[model samples]
Target: MDNTDTPSSARQSLLDATEALIYAGGINATGMDAIVKASGVARKTIYRHFATKDALVAQALRERDARWMRWFSEETCRAEPGPARLLASFDALSSWFATPGFRGCAFINAAGETGDPADPIRIVAREHKASLRAFLLQLAIEAYIADADALAGAWLILIDGAISVALVTGDLQAARRAQAMARCLLPTFFAPTTKELP
Candidate 1:
């Protein structure tokens, strides 16, 4: 298998075109010819870079996972740390949902089309979601919230649900609604300080 990040213009173009095509259409629908035409890279060049279409798709997804996580962290971290910062996660999703050509999460869409749990697309999607959940877990821990793992897991549900709702219903307020639900659930964590003052 060829490395997609080998810092070649042809490889990068293939990666870029593959991501855009698959994201707009789907993994099953996108073809190497379309990628070649869109990227303006020759078919032989694309094959030289990526051993196969799946390899290109996998690499594109991996790169996108990194990019998406960076954007999510930056967007949510813009707010002050605490419950508000946790809630900012939803705000970040809202912003993403409103973006032009927003067609739901790349990972979710890819995984939906993939049946085999062992497929690279499925593995990439799983890893991406795990990374997202880990980020939420970190946020929960940082806020001194109890049951950080559970809260983070639930938050991941809300985030994914909101994305699905927005995509299916064209409702931009999906994230906000999920955020409201999260707010309702958050109060259980708040309580009077029990630790003795130093």
Candidate 2:
């Protein structure tokens, strides 16, 4: 069923609009007026839900993280819990990074706009990263890694590091390297094969 007719749906539209703009541009660059205009929702409505621009930015990051996590769960489950799904996630990230006008990860990019470490936006950003690390650890375990936590941490560092490097260097070859490294490091956890007597 279409949800656009509901208040919750309208609120979601506002969140989606804000996220798209803020992610494509920067949180500092996207203002309340622009969000209201693009979302076709009244400024009063936005203010009604979110008291200030900072609140909106924080909510937008949370919503963005939720949506991303949902998509990641789906994509990472498309194949068996091993190299195939692992590589698929990298492919998805690469494609997302290559999307038109993709500035960077909104949470990561937005953290710079705030001075306070305890700012809601920065908290949301940190939570998003932590959630990703946890998810990767779970995935690594299912892939049968001997030390799933360490392996997942390494892989996540590689994945996020690649994104940062790609955004800075304007090169995506790092994604390929990360994928290769993951494949190389993963097979060590598989159970050893037993020989069949002739």
TM-score of each: 0.92, 0.83
- Report RMSD for candidate 1: 4.1
The window of 10 residues in a row where model 1 has the poorest summed lDDT is: 189-198
Clash pairs for candidate 2:
none
* Model 1 score (lDDT): 0.89
Candidates in order have lDDT scores of 0.89, 0.76
The digit string of per-residue lDDT tens for model 1 on 95-176 reads 9998998999999999999999999889999999999999999998888777788889999999999999999999999999
**Where's the lowest-lDDT run of ten residues in candidate 2?**
189-198
Q: In terms of TM-score, which candidate is strongest? A: 1
TM-score of 1: 0.92
Model 2 agreement with the true structure over 46-149: per-residue lDDT tens digits: 77778988898889899889988888778677767765776666776777677677566667798878889999999999999898888888877666656777
lDDT of 1 at 140: 86
Runs in model 1 deviating more than 4 A are: 1-7, 190-198
